[model samples]
Target: MVLFQEGLRIKMKDLQNTLEDYEQVKLSCDHTAEYIKVQSNNTEKQIKEDFEKLHQFLRDEEAARISALWKEEGQKSRMMKEKIEQMVREISSLSDSIRVVKEKMGADDVSLLQNYKSTLERAQCALQNPERVSGALINVAKHLGNLKFRVWEKM
Candidate 1:
């Protein structure tokens, strides 16, 4: 009977210890869950911040590129316009020269002989042909080539 009582006491102590340990485990599990939640929130915020920074940089880069492209387009277009205007002026001058030659030809023989020297000089157009406008167009290749790779490399 005494040994039975002793054994019962030991079993009661063991149960108490187990219950305490179980409580400790539960507390630890709760702590772990809360820790994970906090960590996950922090990670999410950091990821968003990092992406926002990258996005802002890309936006600024895009704006700068578009501005540069527009500026180049304007400059090249202006250059072409000036070249065309110069060509028109040259054509007008050539037309006037032809009219003068025809007038001189229609003159009498005496007038023709007297003005022959000047007429001949005027007949020979001294105007040099306009130089070919090389690279007068906007260089799209330079802007678009490896664009993604360039942005990644910058990052």
Candidate 2:
């Protein structure tokens, strides 16, 4: 009977040890699951931050391009304005010369002859013919050519 008791005690101890081992395995599984969850969240955060940087880069690129476009527009506008102002001055000068000649024509013969050379020179303006301004507009091709490809390449 004592032998039977001894066997029973040993069996009980073995079962307890098994139970403890099972509990340890369960704890390890839970820990592994929590670690995986934490790691996944960290990876997702890193990816989001990377994308935000990309978006910021694109925004900065867009701002720079738009600023350049505006600068080009202002430069071209100023050039055209200067050309137009020059043409207007030339026209005003021509009109003044015509008026002087007409007034001289109304004068008496001796007075007209006295200023004939000066009047003729006034009639012959030294201005050259206005030439067309080449490359006066914004170069759209420089801004827009292969836009997506260029951006991707830059990125």
Taking all chains together, each candidate's TM-score versus the true structure is 0.79, 0.69
The deviation in Å at residue 61 for candidate 2 is 1.3
RMSD of each: 2.8, 4.2
Question: Model 2, stretches more than 4 Å misplaced?
Answer: 1-33, 106-114
The lDDT values for all models are 0.95, 0.92
User: What's the residue-level lDDT of 54 in candidate 2?
Assistant: 91
Query: Candidate 2: lDDT of 85?
Result: 98
- Per-residue CA lDDT of model 1 for 42-102, tens digit only, reads 9999999999999999998899889989999999999999999999999999999999999
User: How many residue pairs clash (N, CA or C atoms closer than 3 angstroms) in each of the candidate models, in the order given?
Assistant: 0, 0
Worst 10 residues of 2 by lDDT: 142-151
- Model 1: weakest 10-residue lDDT segment is 142-151
- What C-alpha lDDT, on a 0 to 100 scale, does residue 6 get in candidate 2? 100
Q: Model 1 compared with the native: what TM-score?
A: 0.79
